[model samples]
Target: MSDQLVMIIDGMPHTGWKEASIARSIERGPHNFSLQLSEIWNTEKQVNRRAIEQGMSLQAYLNDDLFMSGYINELAPSYDANNHTISIRGSSRLGDLVDCSTTGKAFAGQSLLQISQSLCAPFGITVHVDASAKKAANQIFNKSKRLDLGEPIWEFLEELARVRAVLLTSNANGDLIITRAGTGYADVALALGQNIKTASGNFSGRELFSQYTVSGQQSNEPSVKLESVDTVLPIATVNGSGRYRPFAVAADDDMDVAGCKTRAEWQRNVNQGRSESVVYTVTGWRQTPDGRIWAPNERVIVSDPYQGLLNAERLIVETRLMLNERGRNTELRVMPKNAFDLIPEVESAASEGFIR
Candidate 1:
């Protein structure tokens, strides 16, 4: 059976798109979509120019499953001698956080969940904090948390996420998800000459470095005594196997020595993983052998001899679903599973039954 793509605008469902694309990423960011419709008409054979408008609430669905909840941001209608088309573009609710600045209010010992709720409540965005992230958030802050004036909410949250070693992602329904990475797994595997229609690899080392140093001030006093030393700034370093290139970064203001080390290691791992990346295009908008819809942030097993990968598990970083004259296709960008720095989700007995 063919999958259906429906967009509900102002409580009305429309499915007459001629070309469309939906892009989503595992990163805590916005999912975007664009649709082109050739002269939307009503049952009375009249053009429905009022069907779509900017700022209208929109919900996108695939096979009755809600995929995106957002607002229409752009509307372009064009008419030629014989062809008339309407192009609509929008992003998931997270787009609001990305575009708008935080209130710059300071949080005094507030948990991440509380702070997130305060920031998202204004935009009607919901928050779902994972158990692990909640635990991390509960840690006592050495100093009061404050947002920079006119700083985008997304950027603030991303900085916090890095310091806490968690991930900021969103659900299909557009709710903000503060969680760890690799918590989910894909049921189907991608194999060469099988499910993947096309595969390409990017093995660039421009971003890789031989060493990474993160320097910052630690909040706590040093446990060990250094002879005749009053204080020392905490600094952490990680070494890589690239050209003698060196990289250095400043740790977050709230980070300690341990956090600095974690950040440095994260930088190394993520860049190394990104240095050797792969993109796979598979026919259809879902995985083969199971027909499950493609999703980001899920780990999947891959076997591609041409890429020198054999049963290697990888993480799905992004997914782009496209429909055009050629047909429907799902393009996936994947990297090594260790590219992420968040803690892995622990499995429960009940989850083992369905988790692959």
Candidate 2:
């Protein structure tokens, strides 16, 4: 057996999917052990070999799993030999696998290395002496960047210190008023907008229109529609590819410039011109002079940096965030790069049990 010690780094178990349907594979974390090798092999070779031979990812195989594993993986680690206190100044990993974070500290007089070796032994893990925490951190960092899937995503919500409004329901009474945390002002502005209800059960990202489904009894199954929108640029996007940052929008319905009365009326009233709010349903993108509608790849925003002039093809993969979505944050929210890598779902065929 290798002279290295191995210990099971306990971590939390997680499988990212709804329990009702659509089951995804379970993600596993790796084992963490405290090691202290004699001044012999280089740290670089040891860490690299551990990652490759074990066939584990840093975010997968080590760091993250250790942290998330709670009782097991997140165990307080120590190292020593001969039952003496070897004051460990610090601990770190080598090579590039640094997605998870580790904590270290300067130690006083003690024999920590001996204990580390003893504990690391019998478990099949080896402990090596290394001085650089940066190297180990790098190992976790580099590996996490390249991995396709990762830990669950959580969103942090802050208090609405500004005056805000909660939309009760779109059940027609429209007089829905909700009490908010903030006393007034900012919260008030977030209150009732011109038209916050839609035919669908979704709110308006553009801040002017609400979407209500109107497909008769089949309203639960949404029908994606687009109306024309001229003039002002849309802050959110219709692209389903969830790669875009704060501006990532996936609303199925929206109002347009023609019916965009709030801003227009404000401007008209300021100029003392008698005009109605100029808002309309968001019409589909205009046809190109070549007699074809814009392709999904055509850039909706020609000036944007990340999505500048990109086409609509990516919309197929956007996360359907918001409205009655469950959880604090929508688990459906996927990173843009990952969304495109998805494979189309296969159809299931009816197969009776095979008769022997």
Candidate 3:
């Protein structure tokens, strides 16, 4: 493989970038990329100010393999004593959903996919329902759904997604993808003193708790209330540890007892999964042997004795593909597969036996 980073903007291929960075994360909202060009070393041959503008579509590839697609949102040009540089920055198509507000229109008896399609269509974004989220997509909201004026589109969608126990992400084609965690496995592995150039582990217990209690509101019926309790509030709890470290939160929206329990379990599992993380910096953007591009939401086997990880399988939560004077490197952040899964059933079902 050539391992060259090529970016296409407005149907034109551009290369020889002095520096480039593309960061993506399943936990984050959108994938973003930055490119820097300078005239100091005649690296500005591909610089086309007219073609690089806000809202211009862009695609990035590695070894001619597509990885990122989005629009350019930033353009900066600077001149120093001996160099003239241009910096370009942008995010995946989902960034529009994150930055813009909803239409304040109410929805009734609509499914998740329907709502997503309606909202995203205005921005030229398409909705892709992954098999993992098919059930969630088909789930219909029977009640009257109202959106507050000026409410951010992504925030509203995230609330709906949380209720369904699924996630909203974007693919290389810049289309919104409804999916679950750990959807696939990487073709290669990362091990200490092997493919990984540097490794670091972060183990913290600050966000974790021994117990999580999720509370939510039900109906306003007097029959639902207890002895003198004016209103009825559904509450569910999940244990995290033996200690008394308890954390409580309110539901994102109105839900049932089962939903509350799922929310609590999600909080506990995500915290426990995030409590420990391993970050690895590899030499190139692709796997050493298989040549597959490093991507988020994929599980990979990790064998690093320093972090007590012995051929353990973990989810790739985030990745940063970087190319600078030092050369191309990929930084991967992995955590427990269950961190992003909402319910235990989902987590258990997605788990596969360790890779050989």
Candidate No. with top lDDT: 3
**Model 2, which residues run further than 4 Å from truth?**
1-51, 54-57, 60-213, 218-227, 231-356
RMSD, candidate 3, Å: 9.2
Give the per-residue lDDT digits (tens) of candidate 1, residues 307-337.
Answer: 8789988999999988888788899999987
RMSD of each: 9.5, 26.3, 9.2
Runs with alpha carbons beyond 4 Å of true place in candidate 1: 40-50, 211-243, 248-264, 288-290, 342-356
TM-score list, all predictions? 0.81, 0.14, 0.82
Positional deviation of residue 247's Cα in model 2 after best superposition, in angstroms: 24
Give lDDT per model, in order. 0.74, 0.19, 0.76
Which window of 10 residues has the lowest lDDT sum in candidate 3? 225-234
Per-residue lDDT, model 3, residue 20, is 92
Better of 1 and 2 by lDDT: 1
Tell me the lDDT of model 2 at 174.
12
| Candidate No. with top TM-score | 3
Task: Give the residue spans of candidate 3 off by over 4 A.
Answer: 41-51, 213-244, 249-264, 343-356
Error of 3 at 232 (Å): 32
The clash count of every prediction, one per candidate, is: 0, 84, 0
